[model samples]
Target: MMACIQFLLLFCSFMYIFNVNPSCAQIPNSPIRSLVLPVTKDPATFQFLTTIYHGTSREPIRVVLDLGCPSLWLDCSSGRLSSSRRLIPSCSIQCAAAKPNNMSCAFSAAMPTRKRTACGLSTENSIARSATRGELVEDILTVESVDGSKAGPVTTVDHFLFSCAPRFLLNRLARGAQGMLGLGKSRIALPSQLASKFGLQRKFATCLSSSDGLILFGHEPGYDSIFGTEISRSLMYTPLVTSPDGSGSSQDYSINVKSIKINGKRLSLRQKGIGGGTKISTTVPYTTLESSIYSTFIKAYKESATNNYFLNMTVVAPVAPFGLCFSSKEVPSSMLLGPMVPVIDLVLQSEMVKWRVHGRNAMVPVLDEVMCLGFLDGGSKSKTSSSIVIGGFQLEDNLLEFNLGTSMLGFSSSLLTRHTSCSDYHTRMMQSTLKDS
Candidate 1:
């Protein structure tokens, strides 16, 4: 009996050392139900940034939130190096999961001459259109936890996979941002890792604004009430479709836009239906439409503003990026939304499932006295690849939930209409929690 007991003890010790049981590796009975990241928009670049604590020392790293990127990568040359970081072997299971097609080790000038095996990954700067090779590595990642009503304590993921790129890749990104946090539909992306590690739902939500906003991983039922009505109740969902040309594995979130409308009237487009050429992007600053579509859209908007909203509004000289500009005095401002202007709608699967763009989202103030239409004209359908690219400005102050499990995108149009903005919601939540604490 004593020999049997000793044998059992030895077997348990081996299991503990090797982590044979995945459940034994995690923090037992952890109270964290969801993760929250604070999002802030850069004034100069107009790109949104989110903070995440990484490494054993818990270094806070600010990364641009890119909806199109497939993986998370940082500038390792200048960024702090974590002592706990470990490179995944080229032939390991983790490396296979990250890059199944490429198993060969990466070559870097910085690497030692001594032979070693490490997984190679290609990190790309979508803004600069540059690509660099990096090695796959895993380190501790910490994020703020939330339990619905308030922010909880920080939670740590034992092993988070990311690549380390060279410093030059940081060019064209927002100032102070060291990396890009990819929220795309890839296995190695942030949402996938968080969901897998925490056993949470495979969904994430983004709320972007000029000031600090919130990005929540896994649905927080409490946040649904921030808009005065449950956000889910107000949310309208549209099926997320894959890109054309048979690239179903594309990381970007795309939706089918049936038609475009200005002030409840549909615009006459060169193409009858825009179809599956609309995508959501946080990197692009303004909504971009194909040249032909833009021409018809701008003409319809001008007519609507002149005849209905702003009578005899003065048309000012065009801004550099905006083709249509109007005198600020002619446009009326609303306390709830923004400048009172004609609404723009992107009719989705059905007319009733329209993604409405109100005055606040459709207009941008370029000069003190001039406000211009926020939409931009992408040269042609061939050049742009998409008929409509929904950019960050249009997404600001809107709550967008990407449900990967259901392959659906849920959106709440202009939280300002609900008498609250993204920045306001985040500030209110923090203040209320502080008071309670």
Candidate 2:
């Protein structure tokens, strides 16, 4: 009788523990995950996300998340390194060579001696240059998710490999932050590495707001699932173009933009060279139209574009670099979005997926009332190049999904309005995040 009583008591305790802790449940079918991140304002407002890294270092290393580039390299100027970079037993024969270009382990110019040489790398997009040989080491990286998610971006990999550049001149990073996390098409890319370990597809979804945004893996969380989160609207997908040559560098996101329309007219993109399709970028946020394309667009918008957002302010004249300008005396500063602006839509295909860039998204306020067309002229053209580079500003407040398994890029528009001042937006987002915490 006593044995029977003890067994019943033990079973009841076991059931209670299981019910209280849902984390003890077995793994589910979903291999998907999400990484919620806070957006950065300056340099390129709402252009990039600060990636939080978890590694051997004492302090957390924050790196910029760049999807356009193919390699991961950090600015060691500020990084604290006990093991500068762990050298592979063999860098030559057994170790695989890096991509986009024939980037391999070689001696850096700064330290020419073979004995002193670790792996280093360098680039010259306008021209070809020598590779920088450096050391390859493994490290763990993580980012927090939104809605106070307990299970943030989880990695199945034992250890992820990343290149360490001891010293290098990266002008783009000069204006903002240090280091970069490349999520490009290369096999060495972070997404690919994560997929390899888990035997899952190389896919990710990113929702970009001017403030707090989130990134999801595998699939967008459905409300019923454990990784559930509500999405703004329906998703629109466009097929990605596999590079012209087998080389996948520049082609990770080069989508064929059949046509471009401004205010309802077909704007001509007379490429000086042979062929140039449109590509999307996370680094550059302003839409850069070629000189001829810009000319045609400016002519079209000039007739209808009005600056009524700040009538109380002084209506200053246009200045150099900018095609239009305005000023304010009574209003103090210009308004973000004018009363009414001309509709500028980018038609990718049929009416289904029109990347209708909000008027405010296409205009950058250089100074008070001084707004300029966010588009720029592609100084020189390449034979195998992109006609228009859709910058991040155009993608702000939108959810973008990159599915490598299907070779498709999905777009979903959000109804959220952006704040004129990034600082104000960031503060509000941080406060909201804190409240959730």
Candidate 3:
């Protein structure tokens, strides 16, 4: 009897020892790298505008690509129809460790030059359209140098397929992200095909922020750095941001956070180091808020209490008190569902960099009220700029806020909506309950 009991206990212990954590199995590693790859702070992982100009005739097709994929081209001998057909194979390759970059190429036979009829336009209109089109042709040949050493001539590529959207869609792009490039870690993607051509490693990382439509791509540098005065300087003209106040003061300002409150009382923040020994510089500050924001949301949920319909305010707390009010549809609630933003928001103001213990692992705190207006084309060698404003704050502490001055706060006024098609359920509800009477 004793031996039987001992044997059973031993079996249970062995089973427990061998149990594997499902989460650990799935994630594979801690500190998962982001998809938008540029790890460097300077020149910050090239998201640049690329143009494919047909040889000699000066026709060009425009697109945006991560600079990390060095090899990108357009095949001209093939007409647009054939070019798209031929390039499909190249675009279909899988991205793997063995094959690093996803070099997806769209093709165009020639640049659009003559305009015929947009309803009814004559040759005079065509000539004006041609001039506008001429401005889109980017000169392919230029010298690329870093620290006085020539990386090479910014080569003019040919015989590749490039995509041009309907004219209206093209107009929606910022100056540079106007076209597509090969991203995605697939074999047919441009990054993999051009990996050897551009001396890129097998895998490039890209970090994409929904708040800002900025894609950072590049190999991780084994050093610590910062986005310096230069890159920030060039960002000004990049059409990425629109309607800036032009007062330079806002440029230097980082995020400003109001006090952190829990149950309406505030909390203090303290910094802690991340990596130790030689990696000691990485650090982050943390503080737990007293407010049971989740609890409040639960109460709202319970009061409204329909299993099919529920509400959650997606926000990182510790934002400026006023900035926590209005919500923007543009902000993705899922992405900001992390602990970093609110903790950082408690200490810093918009765009300001507050050192998190070690200068290495810092977070850029942004005002909660600020909303990002995707990309504006800052012209001439400029990348896109993300615009923000100072509106949309929570007065009762549960409202959503957008910092950008011109974003949609609550819904538009009923008077304004009388002329437009604003028939969303929320709009209808507001109309039925609040305005119809």
Worst 10 residues of 2 by lDDT: 121-130
Per-residue accuracy of model 3 over 373-408 as CA lDDT, tens digit each: 111111221112111111111110111111122211
In candidate 2, what are the lDDT values of residues 165-194, reduced to their tens digit?
544534445244556667777665666655
Predict model 2's lDDT versus the native. Answer: 0.52
Local error of candidate 1 at residue 38 (angstroms):
0.5
The runs of at least 3 residues in candidate 2 whose Cα sits more than 4 Å from the true structure, single-residue gaps closed, are 1-32, 43-47, 82-85, 89-94, 97-134, 145-157, 172-176, 198-200, 222-233, 243-248, 268-274, 306-316, 324-339, 417-437
Query: Which candidate leads the pack in lDDT?
Result: 1
lDDT of 1 by residue, 1-437 (tens): 65564444445533433244676656437644677888989999999998888988999888999898888899866667789888876645566567644423233344343225777788888778799887888899988777555677788887788888889999999998898999988778999888777767779988899788988887556356444456657799999988665432378899988888898999987454464469899999999987888888999888988787445567889998999999988677898788878889999999899999988998899899899999999777663377788999999999998999999999998988877888987897688679868
Error (Å) of candidate 1 at residue 379 is: 1.8
Model 1, CA-based lDDT: 0.80
User: How well does candidate 1 score on lDDT at residue 137?
Assistant: 85
Residue 218 lDDT, candidate 3, scale 0-100: 21
Worst 10 residues of 3 by lDDT: 275-284
* Model 3 lDDT, full chain set: 0.23
Which one wins by TM-score: 1 or 3? 1
